[model samples]
Every structure is written in C-alpha cells, then in structure tokens.
Target: MNTCFSSYRSLFPVLGDYVHLASCSQGAIAQPISKAIEEYHASLLSVGTNWEESILKVEATRKKFAEFINAEPDEIAIVASASDAISAVATTLSYHHTKNRISLTDLEFPTAGHIWFAQKHHGADVSFIRSQNGMLPLEQYEKEVTECTLLTFISHVSYHNGFTQNLKKISNIVHHKGSLLFVDAYQSSGQVPIDVREMNIDMLCTGTRKYMLGIPGVAFLYIKKELAEQLQPRHTGWFGQEDKAKFDIYNSIYAYGAKRFETGTPCFISIYAAYEALKLLLNVGVEHIHSYLQDLGKFTREFGIANGLKVATPTASSMYSGMTPFFIDEASKVEKKLKEKRILVSSRKDVIRIAPHFYNTKEELEYAINELVQLVK
Candidate 1:
C-alpha cells in the first residue's frame, strides 16, 4: 500500500455511512463540491447579472478539464450530457451520400450508437463490428474500416464488461484509412489516465455525473484543434455564435473550435457542480487515483475468484479499471441479500458490478467480500 493512497481515503466525507462501491455509475460527492455549489448559488441570488463572471468561471473549469485530459482549452466544449456532446461531434463530421459508412462497436453506449444509426435514415451506411468475448477485436475493426468509412466511434471502456480499448492503436488505424475516430469516454475519463494528444482521438465525450462526482446534466466534448475547424454544426443555437452576447443581431457566425457545438443556454448550476468535482479530481491527481483504483479492482477480482464467484471483468490488473464485475449463481437473490445487509452493489443482467473509489477503505472491501461470500454460500 502506498503512503499517498493511505491518506487519500481521508478526503471523502461519504465513507462514514455506506461502503459506496459504485463510483463508476455515480461517484461519492466530496465536501468541496457541496461548498462550491452553495457558493455559486449564493452568488446567483445576490448578484442578479454576472454573465462575464460566469463565462470566466466556466472557462476556468474547461481549462482544468483540458489540462486533466491533456487537451487545449479551445478544444473543450461544455454540453448537457455525454449524448449531447457525442451528437454534436457525430453530426459535425463530413458525411457524403457516397462515402457514408460509419463504423461503430457493438458494445458502444446507446447514445453513441443512436447517433450513427440516425445517419442510416439519411442514406448513410452504419456498420457495427462485434466484440470478441467482451473485447473489441482490432482485426474486426480493420476489416470493416474502408476508404468509404467516414467515422469510427468506440467507447474507451465498455460499460457492461469493463474491457478497455486501446484508443491510440485504434485511432492510428482509423486515421490511416482516412476516417475520423470519435470516442465515448464516459467510463474511462476520471478513472483512467487519458491524453487526447497521445491517443490521437479526433473527438471525445464524457459526462460529469459519474466518475467525475458531479450533478447530472453537465458534460463535455473534446475536438482536436485541427479537426474542430473542418466539421459543420448541425444543431446550432445562439450561444454557438461568434458574438454570443450580441442579442440585437439576428445573424451571426458560429465560433471556432469546440464552442461551435454549444446548442443553447447551459445548466449553470450543473456546470458549477462539475467544476467543483473536477477540481477535487485534479487536486488528488488522476495518475495517483488510477493506481489506487487498480488496487481495489485487483482485490475485488482476486477475492471473488478465491471465494468461488465468477469474475466477469478482465483478469489482467493493468487492463482493469476500478469497475469489477462478478456473478453468483442466483444474481438477483444475491443482489437483494446484499442490499438488505446494506452492502451496496449493482447488477447488470447476471453480472454484479462493484466499483470502489480512492476514498473507499480496505475494510469496506473486506466487508463487501464477506457479505458476498455469505450470500453465495
């Protein structure tokens, strides 16, 4: 156990009550997040109009997120949800009638899948490369990617199986075929160390509600600086305009970079909450957090296997994130028993998912394992 991680558990206030091994779905809110939101709301109530101040705050938040993900501030766009962000990026791609094939993985979230599917109605071909035993096969993707392929959309981590895709390798393949790579990073953003520049991800979308430890209805998209200028906005709003403050003018051009994707007035409260959440994550450091999560994941997997429970996630610790999926014979019964015992865990079909954050303690992990062992027996 590292000394850095030993002190990491002291930061979160929520560890006192429940074990909270579900940060993959929704992270535990830190005290700083609560304070930040309250202060922002108080400002709104006291000062009636502070658009300039609000913009500054929002830009600061974007810069923090960009720095965390190794991207430029100009490349980041604050949106409502991962779906909204992905939709904006997907619609912006240059899709012609002839070269209209959009490649996607079968394991993609519904939001990303639907965006590409809608293109089929517009005479574009949508192709899905199936995952081999919960892993995206590079060979399958290579076979489907053609000169006609306009975009290849994939999830950085599969939501159900917790299998991580090598984005850098995949992006190279897509770029070589002259196609854009759009990544749904909802599962991997905060939990894993990501660098957009190194990965060569053309576009990426992630929500703040989950591992980001924020309120819902706030998300962001990252578009490569070079590619941002090439795509056209499909659903443009006043905020997307170059002169967003010019209300008197009916006509205005969309701004450059990822801001061109902003559809309308954003949820200010949600953004404020997201800002606080991101700040906490930044302070803790993503690399350190990822290393801690890997330990938790390894513990959960090894414990499950030792106790005769089925391990569903990848066995390789390096490839795994905080998310640990396992199963007992009667998953529903086990879930109910665990919940009744105040041992929180979620079930997806037959697999029980356990995702612990940096704040969670080894005691909590042991308690969860004990409860699971009792239920299995």
Candidate 2:
C-alpha cells in the first residue's frame, strides 16, 4: 500500500491549500497535462507542419487509452464527449430500427437514458428496470431482460448514489437472452480497473472530465471487435471513411474498428490533455488506485457515521466505492460551510457527495469530516 501511495502520489501535483473531494464531478488538472498541451501547441507552430508527427501523437494517445482500459488500440476512438460516444454507438445498433425493447436502470445518467429513449421514435421499446431507492436489484434486472430485449444499457456506477453495478453478471444475463450490453462507464472508468474482455461488455463509453483527469471535451468509446461490423454508422463524416484524407467523391466505405464512430474534426487539445492524463493514471497502476480509493471511501464512511452525518453509501467495503454520499438536515447550508472551509463536496438532491481520488490523504478526509460535524451541529 505504501508503494501504491508513493507511485500514485507522484502523478498529481500537490494542491496544498485545498482538500479536493470532488473527483466524481471533475478531476484535478495534473502538471503533465499542462506540459503536454504546451508541447503540442509548440509543435503546431514549428516548421512547415508535420502531419505524420501529429497522426503519430494521436495514435500514441489512442494506445495509451487502450492500455488504460485493457482494450485493443484499434478498438478505441476519440470523440467529443460521453454523450457523443453513447449516441454514436446507440444510434448505430441495428436493434434501434427494430421493435425490440431496450432495458436500462432507473438510476442511469441522463445521457445514457436519453440516447436509448430517443430510439423510441423509431419504433423501439425502451423499458427502465425500476431501482429501489436508487439501488438496482439484480433479480429485477434479470426479470426485465426478456426475449424481446435487444439491448441492455446501464451505468456501471450510479452518479447520484455511487452504487457500482455488477457488469459481468449483468452482461452474462443479458447475453443469454441474445441482448447486447452497452455500459456508460463515465463514473467508474478511471477510478476502477475495467477489463472489457473479462466482463464481456459489447459497448462501453466514458468521458475524461471526471476521474479521467482530462478536459471536458474529450471521450472515447469501445466496441467489441465482433459487434463493430454489425453497427451501421448513423452519424459519419470524412473521418469515418476508409481513407479519411482521400478526396474521392464516389467510394464511401466506413473505416474498420472504432474509428468509424468519430464524425468530424477532432478536439485535438482535449485529446492531447486526455492522453497525458491517461498516461499518468496508467503509470500509477489502476489496481493500486482502486485499493487506495476503497480505503478512502471506508475512512469517509466511518468518519461520517461517527459524527452526526447520515451515511448514504453502503457500509460494507465490498458494496461501497470511492463515492460516498451522506446527508444532513440542511444540505445546502452544509455545502456552503464546507466551501468556506476550503473543503469541496457536491450536493445531489438531499445527499452530500464526497468523492476523493488516490492522491487525497486520510488526514484530508478527517478534516472534511470534522468540518461537516461542525456544520451539522
């Protein structure tokens, strides 16, 4: 654990003044990200433009992303946002044009829910497996995934309650009924270690802004190699073509692999930043990061309950995660007070969320909790 801390700590520049506990919303900007962007800008200004160098840098970025997620480099495609990634994959699924139903959890993010909902206009049936108090029941999901279900879309981690769903179990259940599992991994990707091959995820999409520690405009999508050929690109541009730079007017064949998802001009700046951010996380090691996060979550949960604050996340270490949601009578007031104390936390509905990353120390958690105890009192 000490070794993990030492390695992980090196990736983040110390923000000594503030105790940042909002990694679920947005991660802190790493120094490497800033330096990478500066170097990229300088490259743009140098010489009579080096197209090959630019493409190689972008490819290297994709390789870094692939390594981070344990995916093939060719299976990754850079996109504008999580929504774009979802829409690209969701719209391409041939089931969207059919009358087959789509299953999703009630606690899904708006982007995941809306993308599936939009397909209803085209004659698809979308059903949300009702979650009990934002907690998804495995049996309920099993019951809802029927023969008519063409796709099952779910958030790997609930943004509101911080519940991490069992994707492997859910995928198996869905696949048995001839349905594909499309996961919105935005909340869980960077903080958690995800292996798509091990989980049998047909399609997964996530943005870099949150735990990924990148700028907001960058995201990526992973399509299982087998499913890539089945998806008919609904939104395609020159970038998706067999030869992106080719000016041929007649031939129109989409590129193989995930590159087919990208539509037009890429957000090069965000991509560059995201690449560096992913590289930093990869160096830190995902398993180490996850263990550190689990410890942080445990510490936060214990401290919150020891005080007067009501703990909203599961008390068990196995069930809970880095995101811990707590509650106080006056959530708004508590949030304001914490902000004044240079402690950051987000309020969702009646619950106050304190999500910290690997870099955050136990001492910081104690400080935040102490402040919360005072606010609640």
Candidate 3:
C-alpha cells in the first residue's frame, strides 16, 4: 500500500468493504464531502439562508480549482456543468465568416458533439477527426484543423476507451494553424495533472463529479486572460454582470475575466462539496495521484488481457487514463452482478469500464477483474 494515499483511504468509508472502480462515472464519496453537505444543511436549517457565506465558498472553490490547473483565479468561471461552460464559450464565438470552423474528434463525449454541432444554426462549420481504432492520430489534426478553423475542441481523455490525447502536441498543431484549443477535461481532471499555461490551452472545462471526488451541479472553466477579454458571452446573466450586487439592469457590463461566463446563482450545496473536494485533491497532489493511477491502469489491462478479455483501452501507458475498459457482451448486466457483490463498476455499450482512483489497492482491482471475468464467461 502507498502510505501517502493509504492514510487517505480512511476518509472514504466506502473502501472498507466495497471495491469502487467507477471513478470514470462517479468517484466514491469521502467523509469530507459528506461533512460539507452536512454543513450546508445545518446552515440552511439554522439561518434559513446562507447566500453570503456560500458565495464566498464558491470563490474559494474557484481559486482552488484554478490552482489545481495552474490557472489564474480570474481566468476561472464557476458553472453548473461542463455543457454550460462549453455553451458560454461556444455561443460567444463568431461563426459567420472565414474563421468559422470548429474542429472536433469522434472520441469526444456526446455532449461535445451535441454542443458544437448545434452551432451550425449560427453558420458554424463543424468538422470531425475520426478516431482510428479508438485512438485519434496527431496527423488527423493537421489535416482537419485548417487555417479557417476557429477552435479545435478536444477531450483530454476519452470516456469510452480511456484514450488520452497529447495536449501539448495538439496545442502546437492548433496554434500553428492559428486556431484556439478548447479542452474538455471532465474525464481527465483530478486523475491527470493539467497546467493551462504549460499546455497553452485557450479554454478548458471540467466538472468535479468524477475523479475530483465531489457531487455534480458544479464545474469550473478556464479561459486565457487575453482571450476572455476579447469577447462577451451571449449566455450572460445578472450574476455575470460587472457588479452582481449593483442591481443596475439598464447598462449591462459583463464581469471581467471568465466570471463573465457565469449565469444565475450557483448550486450552493454542490459548491460547498466542491470546496472541500478540491482542497483534498490539492493536498494529495495531482502528480502523485496520476502516477499511482497509471500503475493501476497498467495492472488492469495486463490482468484483463492475460485472462482472455478484449481490453479496449490503449496498451501504451501514456496514451490512457485511469479507465481500463474491456469488451464484454451484456456489459450492463455484468455491471449489475458486480454491484450485487459490492464491487461497483460502470458499463457503456459493450465494454465494462474499470476505473480506479489513488485510494484503490491492486488486490481490490484483482478481485474486481476476477469477478468480472467469471461473470462475462
């Protein structure tokens, strides 16, 4: 057991008996997250409302998340979901003229396609770089992302097969063609280390439900400071104004930085949960979490292959995230059987996804894999 992470396992009581390998779909709940929820409920029950304190919590969470990604606090925006973050940036883009192409790939979660494809109504030209055998080729970006491409949206890690992209290389490709890079880090954040400045990401969005160890209803967005100042989001609301407390509706001046992307009041309870979760992740350190998860990922793939399961995740360690998915018929059925045995996993299509976090032990993974193999056979 890694002594550094082993101590943290006590914080997540679920690990005592159950084997949770579903960090791709949802992270196992921790005690801190539970306490955060209780604190929110207590405030509400006692004071009737906790708007002022909750807002401060939101700012703290925003700053923590910014630190998590090595971005400026001003560059971060607190939104309801990754979809909402994409919408704010997507809607503000000018898709009428020469630079109207939105480049994406097949590996993206459906939400990425749904959001960008919807931009066609605004005269946006959306092109897709099809994945070859569950992996996208770097040359595909060179071919598809042309000079006219405005933004090339990519998921840092694929939700289907755990295929992770090379952000720095792709950023170079997109920037060489004078196109902006928009990364959806929902599947990568908390499990992988991301530095917006080092990666040269024009925009990025990630939610805390998965590897961040928090509930849904809150997400963070990072936009380059210069890029954020260039345009105003069409999806702005009262909270997005320069002075949300001013209540001056006549002249609408958007808030400076990525805060302009925010809409109405945030999900306060979820924000409270996110604050503690972010603090926990930061304290543990993303670099350490990534290294531990990679070792687990390798263990999963090797064990599955040796057991005759057709693993769908990339064989290369660098090209994959924490998720190790193996092809199986009736995957959802197998997932249920595993759940009945107190081993939790997630299934998408014909593959059962086994994603582990830093808190997971190799023995737990072996047990989950052995059980899954038997169920599939």
Colliding pairs, model 2: none
Off by over 4 Å in 3: 1-3
RMSD of each: 2.2, 2.3, 1.1
Candidate 1 lDDT over 144-178, as tens digits, reads 89999888888888777788888999998899998
Assess every candidate by TM-score. 0.93, 0.93, 0.98
**lDDT of each model, Cα atoms only?**
0.81, 0.81, 0.91
Task: Give residue 310's lDDT in candidate 1 (0 to 100).
Answer: 80
Cα-lDDT of candidate 1? 0.81
lDDT of 2 at 7: 48
Model 2 misplaced stretches (Cα beyond 4 Å): 1-14, 45-52, 96-99, 315-317, 328-336
Best by TM-score: 3
lDDT of 2 by residue, 1-377 (tens): 35346545555664466788888888877889988778778887876475676677678888888888778977887888889988887677665444378888888877777788897776678898887755777888779988888888898888878888888999889999888898889989889899998998988999998888888878889988777866679888887777977878788887888887878877777778988898888877778888889888888888888886788765443656699989767676788888888888877778888989877888888988888887777
lDDT of 1 at 302: 84
Better of 2 and 3 by TM-score: 3
TM match of model 2 to true structure: 0.93
